[model samples]
Target: MSSRERVLAAVAGIAAVAAAVAAPGAAATGRHQDWDETAYRGQIEVVRSDDGPSDPTVLNGTVFVDRDRDSRHDRNERGVAGVEVSNGREVVTTDRRGRYRLPVYDNMTVFVTQPAGYQVPVDEFNVAQFHYNHLPAGSPELRYGGISPTGPIPDAVNFPLVESSLTDDRRLSCIIAGDLQTYNLTEVEYARKGAIADLARRNDYQGCGSLFVGDVVGDDLSLYDEVKGLSAQTNGPARFLPGNHDLDFDATTAVHSFDTFRAQLAPAYFSYDVGEAHIIALNTVRYPCTPDLDNVDGLRPGCNDPVNRPRYNGHIDETQMEWLRRDLAKVDRDKLIVIAGHIGLLNWADEGSAIHQVDQVREVYELLHGRKAVALAGHSHSIENMRTGDAMQGWRDLFGIDSLPFPHITVGAIAGDWFSGRVTEDGYPTAIQRDGGRPGVLTLDLADSSFQERFTVTGENDRVQTQLGLNTPTYREWYVARSAWNSNPVGAAPELGDPLVVDQADLAGGTWLTTNFFIGGTGSTVTVRLNNHRPRQAVRTQPMRGEDQFVGPEWSDPAAVAEQLVHGGSVANRTMHLWRFELPTDLAPGTHQAHVTATDVHGRRFADTLTFQVVAQR
Candidate 1:
């Protein structure tokens, strides 16, 4: 069968399974029993009083050295001084007694900025318990049970820490996974075999550990346990940040929106230090979204207009900005700052959107002035490595970012394309991404303050960097035909005619070799050599500087499209890292090998080889 027919057949075969798995009743029992409809049933407008006591509420906390490794401050435990703490807005250091007092308000999360040479106590699920949520009245009535009102402010809320050698070394490796987003148990299995299994076999990241960049589950707060179980399989501590999907949609107020998440995971946003890197996890998602015509969800009459209903948007509130300013002021300017969040500060996939990109990117840039910095995000499922000086007109016009100050990467998802496509022998889904990239996790290997990033494709090694294909008229015809077939119901299966066999007519018509470098970016290079000939540079298909997106076969990676179009997933439309080179028409017909080498912006290189037959005619 042709590619389109295969995709349709696959969909038809799984239609009943999808229906049974997605049935409303299926989600109402077992792990999903706690998923209340009130949380997402209707909208409720949240109002708060601006008025407060004239006197600041002094909340005291002790950062004690847990000699016993327990998460409690025993009578014999000694306080460790000089550690920094925050009440989500103001930053203060512990006194000589390792005691800190910060003004607290209702709905404030006071957390310690984990210091190097010390480890914060982890909960049973390995979630760091360094923060104390001080919501006096707890969360308002909603589903997914938000924070229970902590009644009144306590006199003391102490955090326990133990000395550790994990973060004392100069070398650090961190695993960054994006969007586990398992809507059901089957998808969870896909994750176990995919990135989680890869992480379990590795011993590299003992200090920095793994940070899942949001979307831990698909709105079902009950699934947090299953997700946590998956994290337990990893070799190191697993940290999580909240995504738009992690929100308690029935929340009536912004303060209580992420209560369930904070309770199950870590605080909404926090910071820590390991070696020379200071990691800042920010809560960049703003919910109960104010009405915006630019909202990507396409909600009727906008988010704020229809009041009471909660909608999410990518924005950094003033309080978080204040916290960031205070947090960075205490850090050494020479240390590398790694800022991570759910939604990206800026991305190429949603180039024309303000909702996907942070609203205060310029302000964020100014805050990190004179410091070495890099950002990691994952709301867009595509893989993007945006180097400094990479400029897109949309980013410039929307966020006033003339050029990237540092690398801003969108890590590919662990649940690639939401775990779609056929299952593989490895017990995972072949969920190819919208950009035609495979599922993977990104690793930031750090030596002191400097670092380099590499993407490890799930079930594959680091060497599998580039995908090769031939961009000929036959492939282009198949592309158009397949696109039309997937969109309409009556079209026949898309046949590529013969992708492997290239004719003299194809060579005469100027067919080219295509390379899809998964982690490649601007300043990167791709070179191709055929039959031991001299190496030739392959030009990038789309230059990221101020241009509209170039899509279609001429701009796509044929190797990826070949699998994605046939397997039932997103088509590889446009990629910033794709490169192409024209093939010679004078060569004699024979089987040939093309050796491809790809070098990233940091001078790291990966190599792969592709073999194809050259024939005069079919």
Candidate 2:
């Protein structure tokens, strides 16, 4: 090629990189879509060799500062003491010399818990590399090709760290994303335009970064790279937790269930300290669950064997449990403990499901009895902000638990009901959730131990929080007359026309102004004002006081069901976050405006308005 052609080609390449980078994030967000191959990325420097004599009994490592950012511990690089290292079982801190040793196992992951003051290294995709997966015997024959054999334990598994002021401050903004369960490449691009684009546009959350709480893919591990590529376009480092979908079904035993996950992402269960919060990401899913796994006696039969039909139970294995205990033992008593997992310890969406709720829920609560803590999870594909003292009959009947001891928030999914809905202008499905929440990401804004969580809906700004609609007798009748959605959606059903329009018979039959507060819980309140009249308080449907879940059309969100019925998705027949205000019986017939203001547990208020017509007759 001539010099002129070379210059033009270089300019075109630069423009392509610029366009891809600028398309995702806002200006100065400091995120990029593509990364230079040879540029030095901050990552845990693993200086190991296979040709040397190895010690399979124990592993040793040094946590040192990589001054040159070459992911290497040269002579000039000094040791950083007090860094905690774990072998997935025991937690030990480095000595003054920054050297520590631990007993090794065949299927253990050795990772350095990123300390608050220093930043760890990252890969090209900006995935923090803090752990080393040690699978000496590799894995059993599985479809995803679980962790390859590491041959032998290396001489040293040193971890590299670079000093940064990112986590040095007390105020922390951590993004908790959920269930990027992309089944195929098409769905993958859908995720890119949805929450991923939302994350890329923000520059905050550098302290704790983004913690994806499970269901990274929909049973296909090959999509791991695609999902990782999505993270590359984001601002902060990306961390992942394993869900039921992120498992190797071919693994007969639970030991190697997440070997491929460990090989691809970080450890299945790990902990990190960012600013004032100590984040503990737990592996709460037990694949091929056994009745023996449940201490609460909640799991059913036919879950013992995987070859026949593999079932998963929400229970943490003894290994991870012990590791959690050891890891938490190192944290300070007053610091905020953010316990994150795939299956929630207990949630409103799956309150009654023995297989969906954690068996050792009480055990986990007991462990953090006197600590300032909160829990975040995903997998139910619903948004639930369950606070302390919030009670559910299902939690009582299944786990014998009366009420929540701490705040347990179920962060909703990116793949809203498996991406089931009509295509949007953004080139993705509307993908409304089973609980009537739009696809979004959860952000925990913290100052010291105090925190206030806010959910940002996809393809919209943070101000969009509540969904207002009218639930009339007409909607109930239509809901009952709707097709058998379980099978192929076959059957003609008439739309409710205008959901806000209620006839005199409907008002007499009890019409209600429903507000589906996506993140509302026990302490939340929804107030409604009809035609700017006196505001009336809305009552929560579930009550969340150990009451059994109310299902069918009465407790449903008509607006969500309207979309779910026509677009093909999980029907929103039941949810704990719904609030209803009854309409006056002697209401004047005409169009009227209803003003809605929803106040969350933190006393944060969101206001919206809806215009509905009241006809004399249908």
Top TM-score hit:
2
- lDDT digits (tens) for residues 196-312 of candidate 1: 767655657766778899998988887777787676555455788999999988876566678999877888988999999999998888776765533544522345642555567
- Deviation of model 2 at 499, angstroms: 1.7
Consecutive 10-residue window with the lowest summed lDDT within model 2: 31-40
Against the reference, the lDDT scores of all candidates come to 0.79, 0.83
- Those runs of model 1 whose alpha carbons end farther than 4 Å from true positions after fitting are 1-56, 292-310
Q: What digit string (tens of lDDT, one per residue) describes model 2 on residues 1-618? A: 653354345334433443454433222334322233322376665666656436658888799988888887798888889989999899999999789899988778999988988878778676888998888788888899999988788878889887766666677688899999999878987987678877765766765678899999999998887777777765677899999999998888789899889999989998888888889999998887765664335356656555687888888888888888888889999899999999999988878788887878888888999999999999999999999998888888888899888899999998988899999987899899999998888989889888999898887777778998888888898877674533545665566677778889999999988999998988889999889699989999988877888998999987798899878889999998999999898999998999999999888899999898889987
Best by lDDT: 2
In the predicted model 1, the residue pairs found to clash are: 39-250, 43-308, 43-309, 44-308, 137-149, 138-149, 291-304
Candidate 2 residue-wise lDDT at 610: 89
Using Cα atoms with residue i matched to residue i, what is each candidate's TM-score against the true structure?
A: 0.88, 0.93
Question: For model 2, what is the error of residue 334's alpha carbon versus the real structure, in angstroms, after optimal superposition?
Answer: 1.0
